[model samples]
Target chain A: MKTITNKKNILYSKKELGQIQLLLPVILVVTVFSLAPLLRGIYLGFTDYRLGDPISFNGIENYKQLFSDEYFWNSFKIGMVWTFVVTAIQVSLGLGLALLLNSKVRFTSFYTILILIPWATPPIIRGILWRQMYEPNTGAVNILLTNLGLISAPINWLSSFEFVIPAVIVAGVWGEISKAAIFLLAGLQTIPNDLYEASKIDGAGLWDQFRHITIPVLKPVLAAIISLTFMWNFNTFGIIWVLTQGGPGGLTRLPMLAAYEEGFKYGYIGYAAAIGNVMVIILSLMLFMYIRVQLRERTES
Target chain B: MKRNIYIVLILLVGTILFFLLTRKNNNHQNIPLRFVSLAWQEGTIATNKSIVNEWNAAHPDIQVEYIQGTWNSAHDYLITAFETGDVPDIFHYESSVIIDYAMRGYLTDLSPYISSEMKNDILDVAWATVTRPNGEVDGIPFLIESLVVLYNKSLFKKEGIIPPTIEYPWTWDDLQSAARKMTKDTNGDGVIDQYGAGLGLRNSANIIMNTSISFGGSFFKKEGNHFVVKVNDEEKKLLQTIVDMLYKDKSVSPASIGETGAGMIPGLFSGRYAMLVGIGSWGRQQLVENAPKEFQWGVMPPIKAKTQTYGASTQTLSIPKKSKRAKEAMMFIDFMLSSKNTARLALNDWMIPARISCLSMPEFKDKIGGWDITCSAVSTLSIGSWLGAPGYVEWKSRVANPVLQELFAGRMSIDDAARRIEHESNIVLSRYKKRGEVW
Candidate 1:
């Protein structure tokens, strides 16, 4: 009996050891490729390292310069506005679409799949398609509008600074709304039918039930989606770059575009890295706040 | 347990297979010469590929590979590669970036390699554009381009305006009158459907400088070899006058101010504009490929400014200093620039051959549909006249572009714009001074 027990214990230990060995490769890969590069980038941000030159310590000069740079500040303001507007619209539309699809409506599955097309397509392709659509003349949108007698002439959608950002946001939201909708739709599936039935039994109206049960239940998922979307929108460079190239007097210049222009076009790598580092800090604080709110709500519930 | 043993065996086999494949790839002895280029048009790529193939065939010891990237991304890609010490053997670069790269010790000077005869074969302007002030030939001269005034012949005939004589080109006043006459509201619409002229706001400084020179205004007075801008007096007035015509006269389209979809070159090709200011290389192709047969177009000689006309620098090929195959690369470049191949490549690509002998060749002239017209447009460069300036790259980025943007927005007067440019340009120059650098 003792020998048999010892053998069982040894077998269990061997299995556990084997499982840890299997996980080591994945852990090493993530550390090397993702975490190490990110940490190294942060370290490089503090140095005055031009391309093809040896790096040297610069202390707080880069940061100090960034603080006073008008272009940087303007891009930061634009980034914040972009994040807030895109996040609010994306979340509201996504939740609404998810709720609509969650109901016992006809063709719900087909419609859900159809909405995923934009999300499934590449961001560059989406940007290019939207650019063609928004072309001032000989574009589908202008042609349709003119035929409908909506306007007398074509609108310069991208040329005007006032319209360029919104035009980019329209394309950005097309992708983001689908992603958020899918996430919320999955969250909706987890809600028990009994909960809604109980609410109805208590004589609560549909709006009241949604306000009470659905939103509260979706709070955690919604917070996560919004935080992720905000980060993505803050780093949104491709759509704007493809459409405007931060042109027409730099009105549409986002933080990422500014960083790219400085680093690549202007050959100011150290300054660009500083800009990137500040962006990371801002995004990290935002994420931390979001996670704190979510955790706090969870504990209270 | 038996299934686990089979899985282990499969994993072992896979590892061995991967090792063998990698080893096989590593065992290849011929070092591949990688060439990165921004010239990715079908004809350009085909020509490059043929050259690479020919070189490889002759030199079996080395194999060559070519990577094509877009113009917008090529500079960034090359910079990144240089930083990483992975630069290709040879690359195509714009004239603006040559000094910047050469100053950083990224380019290999070719002065020591080429024969004097071969150097003399290249045009003097082409040679000057590629050579640094210190007499260092940092890049090999290949093709040369000059800016030309392209006007629609049909429009000129319809308006009964004689084209400018090549010997005595039109002045700014003549250009203004021509443009005013050309602009029309065809179909009796309140809006003007046809524009008189189109200038690329994208490179407004080049156009501005060209126009300014015609007004007898020099950007700088050369003292010995050093160039300094005459920013305060006549040049300022010339700049104001040009801007007034562009914005106040309303002869050009509002598209210059970002109102319409009509971009400069494409607008000209589509018959939306009567005249266009574009580079000779691009203009040559535009005439051949897109211009309608019945719509005749003629090239106007470079507009004169007090005995000279405005001309910009052109493209050159350079090898990276870090390249292991510099000898072979130089040989290939020399072959490409030979009169025979140069003419062949230039004709196919619609680029002006840098070789003076090839310029008069019938094969070179007849490549594009409108040969004499295009030749006459750039003939001013044969004489010694150009829009040369120091800190061209910095001036373009920091001063000229922003001020032009303001002008396009109609937010600043031409005088105010010139003053603002002078202020900002001084700031940029001061920074360069602090660095103790001229470029």
Candidate 2:
């Protein structure tokens, strides 16, 4: 009689309890896969654990070593520069293309589809194709350049320290810009045509209307795109790895590549984990700052 | 409706549980063995397919499965697999990585399983790579690779330059002069249409180490139980000379520093380059498939410096420590290394069989062109040693590669590069020094 009364007085209503029971599979999946791995990685970061060896606690030695390591810092610097430059260029180009496509031009859909090809293709395939195009000889770019008398000789686009990073950036942007453009195009569709019509009737020129109406209207979309683009560029590894392998004297070495070399190639698993942990922290900080800025802007408006 | 949904969910969960339990039971009964490899080439695939068929045919109780991985990400994937305690029973790895894996205790020691007769049949240098300093063999010798000069016979004939003979093997200087003579501006367009050689220095450390060893410069000197890098006088001289020949002499293409996509033997293939220095394994393949019928190609012994020559160490097969079927894994390795099977695999794979008897098999000689020369070059592995140290992998990433790149790009002086490598390598080495491990 007491047990029946206690069950009846439970916080969850019968319907709510049934609903909660239905969510067990989702909860189990999150716990087993995502949460478990995250916890394991964090735990291993503080231990002197090799891949197959008996793990031992090492406190913060791995983290300390990372802080002092010149290579790690260099890679961080490269990652930041890469993230900023690629994101800015890709976003602006995407927005510009989006605006152009938004116009009532003939074959606009066909042109948009063609531009989307790069984004639709796999990143690995895109990287390989771009690498071929950037080849020093027999590549389309060099052949075209030489034929047009733009340059007397072929350029080693992915070979030199100076050119390799920029070459990778161009390839990365090629893939990313298309996606950003499509996203912005969708955002552009949401803006009512009457807003532009009203501005034009009031004798507003293209630049003024774009700045006052289109730019303000696209702010949220632009912010989201920029932040997401920055995250993507920062985490990019496949394109750079396939193209350069961070070569020509480590000019294009990024943090992820460094972490990879440390963990797998050299068997410094703990150190690699520490590098990963640092990346998580750094990326999280960037994300937080982005959100904070967005909130601040919203508050000010 | 809620009761009906709950009943459906219960049934689904029960079905999934039953399936998983049955799968687990089936796995246990069969003792499934998985072989993981990243050898994507046609020959390697053929060899793997044949091996799997043979293994399955021989062992009725045991079954084997194969997993394919891409070369670029295979090592990383394997490492993750090992960390998660899900390693394959057998895997292929380069000789350099064997030590790295062994040090991490990820490999099973195979010394006890290997017989004296079997050990005697394997080449000493190839065996040495798998053997730890304490005389524990960590892997089975799969194949041996040696460096040989691959030259375009037609290009040599066209230039009226007699190819180096077996009796009168060319020296490094002789090869360089020959290459300079072969290089030409065929179209007279002021740009060189033909190059003397196509040297790939993009993957620098391996090439540099091979060149250094051929020039008789040992990167490390064995002292008691340990090895110390001797980047002092002799090594520096060798490093400088190679850099000078590669960049200053311009015998190799200037574009080689940045351009490797034109293929490893582009010059030889396109009739633009006269000579290429590459692994003997390449010569074996050229003998079988790649050699143009219009032009006869031949192998020259590796160019002699102070020492005879050196080649990048070939890959070996190892059983991961986490493998449940270690005994069966050892048996598979033994079968793979057996004279009959090795010779059979070698015939198709176009690599020097690690087994001594298989290498001497006359059938290999008749199968392809230039095999005679390649076999001879490979046999010289008796003289040279594997080029790796305890921390050699890290040294490669931090010092050797970057320094060599600087050398190739003409950004740093050879002496400066050598000094930098020495300093950086010591720092890398010191980390392992604490563990008391030796190269």
lDDT of 1: 0.72
- Residues A136-215, candidate 1: write the lDDT tens digits: 76677778889999977677677665667788888888887998999999999899999999999999999998999999
Residue-wise lDDT of candidate 2 within B285-382, one digit each (tens)? 64446656666666776677776666547668888888878898778777766788787766666667777787678975652455666666664554
Q: Give per-residue lDDT, candidate 1, residue B82.
A: 78
Residue B28 of model 1 has an lDDT of 48
TM-score leader: 2
lDDT of model 2 at position A208:
97
DockQ numbers for every candidate?
0.36, 0.59
Candidate no. 1 TM-score: 0.88
lDDT of 2: 0.76
Residue-by-residue lDDT tens digits, candidate 1, B1-439: 5457557657766886898788565334576777776665567778877877887888787677777778778777888777766678778776656767776668888888888767888878677777776677777766766666777777778778888865567776787778888888887968777777876665466556655655566555555544454465556666555565577677776555553221455667676778875445556565666666666776766666554455546667788888767887777778666787777677766776778788788865552354554555444553212223445565675567657776766777767876777666665545444444443
lDDT of 2 by residue, A134-180 (tens): 88767888899899999876777877876788889888899989989
With candidate 1 superimposed using the best TM-score fit, by how many Å does residue B169's alpha carbon deviate from the native?
1.3
